[model samples]
Target: KHILRYVRGTTNMGLFFKRDGTRRIVGYSDSSHNIDIDDGRSTSGHIFYLGSSPITWASQKQPTVALSSCEAEFMAATEAAKQAIWLKELLKEIQSIEEKVILRIDNKSAIALTKNPVFHGRSKHILKKYHFIRECVENEQIEVEHVPGKEQKADILTKPLARIKFKK
Candidate 1:
């Protein structure tokens, strides 16, 4: 299978972490909207890194169906924010260091919704749980930022990629 080949081909590749001055916890959130043809649901993915090395990552199907790409991205960011909170608490307890948690999302609109408390026709129907990221941003627990699609590390977890792109 391709997975087996990939693993074999990358036998020498691995994540390497080094002691750095910055103790920032950076996260990337991404979603593939309407990827599930069965129910039109979306896939959510998140990856967190301590300094420049990845610490944790997750990819799962979303529970609810998102009506728009923005909604899907918002839900994904919410999932990532929950993990960020847990990581923040764990780091605080274990290392006694409060690091800056920044979650990068490629969707700018979703980032805006988190920063601004706004409701309209498009976002009114979204579940209240998806709004949790807004609270996270307001409390300064984590920052939701904008990242370009090509630089979105979580993209690999959300959707399938071509052979060339996958190698990258």
Candidate 2:
């Protein structure tokens, strides 16, 4: 099948884990507006790295339609935080490191939501499960930082853009 052929051709592509300390373990997450006209669901994407090389990445549709951009980004960060915790556990078992995992998201509103515990009317509609990111932050398992939208690489998987625009 064409899909199989494509997979075979891209077998060389993947995350490269390095023992060198030149890189830092960090993650990036992004999401698109609800653009699936039929379903109204947004896409979620995340990528992790050990320094400059990638260690894990994924792209998938959100389970439900996001009521706003902040919601979509929050979902993406939740997924990324889960992966970050898993990766940290894996690294501890196989190697020794004393650094906390860091996650980068472009949505300032989402970042604010995670930092603030006051569940007001705006955030009341978010599903309960997605609040796990806050717990993870409190436990020091993961830290979410704000990155500018133009610098978010996870944008590649969550939406379509022109070649020139994407490269930027």
Candidate 3:
């Protein structure tokens, strides 16, 4: 009963999309380190935008526990890359020529890890699947850049934000 009420109340809400003159999809990823006390797993979040409006987004608990904050962010980024590739392909249906997808992550270390293979020793313990982002970066299918935590829209999804931040 409550669910239906919430849905009905929000039915009038809609997304506003404007042409930003940029034919590209951009994404932001964030993760909260070990927020799930029971499993010691982090929550991963990502949001993709077409122009200034969000096209797709996700927030979920990581499948595995990440030993460090960097690892948690790294894993979160890998998931975001997967979503970016999928969204990029979907964009091809309407636009034949699309620019490379860019993903913004707040963690500089994870961004660097995605670009260089020299961190092999540090990353070897991570699940092999999480390494998919490295290939995506090397192939130039997606580009990862650093975005400060305050500007990360996905911050709301990874963890609970203070009332002030939430209002932003």
Candidate 4:
């Protein structure tokens, strides 16, 4: 089976956390727009890292349908921003995190929406709850950065990928 082969080939693979690795929290968020036929909802996912090692991650179906891929990605980023704020607060208990957490998103439109208040005609339909990410960005809690789709590691969590792409 494919799973057995995968397990056999990665017996020695593991995440190594360095003692002196950067303490900053970085996150990658992604979504598969309108993937669920039953409800017409999208799937959202995010992965967080401390230095180079993954610290936390999530993948789940979105509660509502998104009219566009941009909207779906924006919602995903909003979820990640919430998690980032929590992580920042938890880390504050031990040490100070002076820099805003960087949340890498693959969609340029979503990043623009978070940074700019001006909304497009199509974007007007998106719910208000998803707009919280914009507040987070403005408050210095998180920064949304555009990452090319090919480099988005959170893609694996949003949907199934081909073997070649999954390896990336």
Candidate 5:
């Protein structure tokens, strides 16, 4: 009954994707800084969309604990990039997409990491699985850019915020 009640409340919660919508697929990504009290691992959150409607969204704890806030955000961005590429391929199968996916991340350091070739000592310990995003960047399949934290929509999934912040 609780599940049914929640479902009823979510009657307006739906995503609309149109065939004629713009081929531009964009993504928003965010992360919490050491929110896990037990292991101190950060949580990564991402949402991808076809035009304005979201096609995919996820929020999960990072397997390894991050050393810094930037590292946590960087890992979250990497996860988003991975999903963007997958969605691109899926969309290509249904229809041709002209515009490359643009990923918006709130952390500037994470954006810089995507462009930087040399990995610093602190970042070196990150799992190799996340480097797939680097390959996507080099191939120009996805581009990560800086976005101000105040406007990061994915923040809602990653961490709690004030009602005013969430409303914006």
Candidate 6:
């Protein structure tokens, strides 16, 4: 099987965590819009890293159908934001994490929606729960920033990628 072959090829490879590295938590969130043909729902994906090593990740179908790509991505970011908050709290018990968690997203519109409180007609249909990320941003708990699509690590979890691209 292709998965078996790939696993065999990287049997010795693994994530390395540096003791002297930064303790900040960084997250990458992405989505595949309208990926589910049966219901036209999207797939949300996210990866959280402590320093350069990945600590947590997720890939799951959105519960609600998204009408637009921006909506799908916003929902994905919201999911990641929730995870980031949990991680922040966990880390606090060990050692204080003073810096705000950085959540990287590939969609510009989604980033804008989180940073701006203004309600737009296009986003009026989004569920109220998904707007929790905006409150986190307002409280200085998480900071959402733009990441280029090609550099979004969460893409690997959302959909299949070429072997060469996946290696990156």
TM-score of 4: 0.90
Off by over 4 Å in 6: 1-3
Off by over 4 Å in 1: 1-3
Q: Which stretches of candidate 5 lie over 4 Å from their true place?
A: 1-20
1-168: candidate 1 lDDT, tens digit per residue: 999997899998777888786678999999999999999999999999988888899999999999999999999999999999999898888776565689999999899888988787889999998899999999988888899999999999999987777767
lDDT of 4 by residue, 1-168 (tens): 999998999888776777655888899999999999889999999999978878899999999889889999999999999999999889888887777899999999899999987777978888999999999998988988999999998999999999899665
| All candidates in order of lDDT, best leading | 6, 1, 4, 3, 2, 5
Candidate 3: regions farther than 4 A off: 1-14
| TM-score of every candidate relative to the true structure | 0.92, 0.86, 0.89, 0.90, 0.86, 0.94
Clashing residue pairs for model 1: none
Kindly list the per-residue Cα lDDT of model 3 for residues 1-168, writing each as its tens digit.
999996897787677888888777889999999998898999999999987879999999999999989999999999999999989988898787468899999999899889986657778899889989999999999989999988999999998889788666
TM-score of candidate 5 to 2 decimals: 0.86
lDDT of all predictions, in order shown?
A: 0.91, 0.86, 0.91, 0.91, 0.84, 0.94
Q: Is candidate 1 or candidate 4 better by TM-score?
A: 1
* Per-residue alpha-carbon lDDT of candidate 6 for residues 1-168, written as tens digits (9 for 90 to 100): 999998999988777766656899999999999998899999999999988889899999999999999999999999999999999999999987989999999999999999888889999889999999999999999999999998999999899999899667
lDDT at 84 for candidate 6? 97
Query: How much is 25 displaced in model 5, in angstroms?
Result: 0.7
lDDT of 1: 0.91
Q: Which candidate is the best by lDDT?
A: 6
Global CA lDDT of candidate 3, please?
0.91
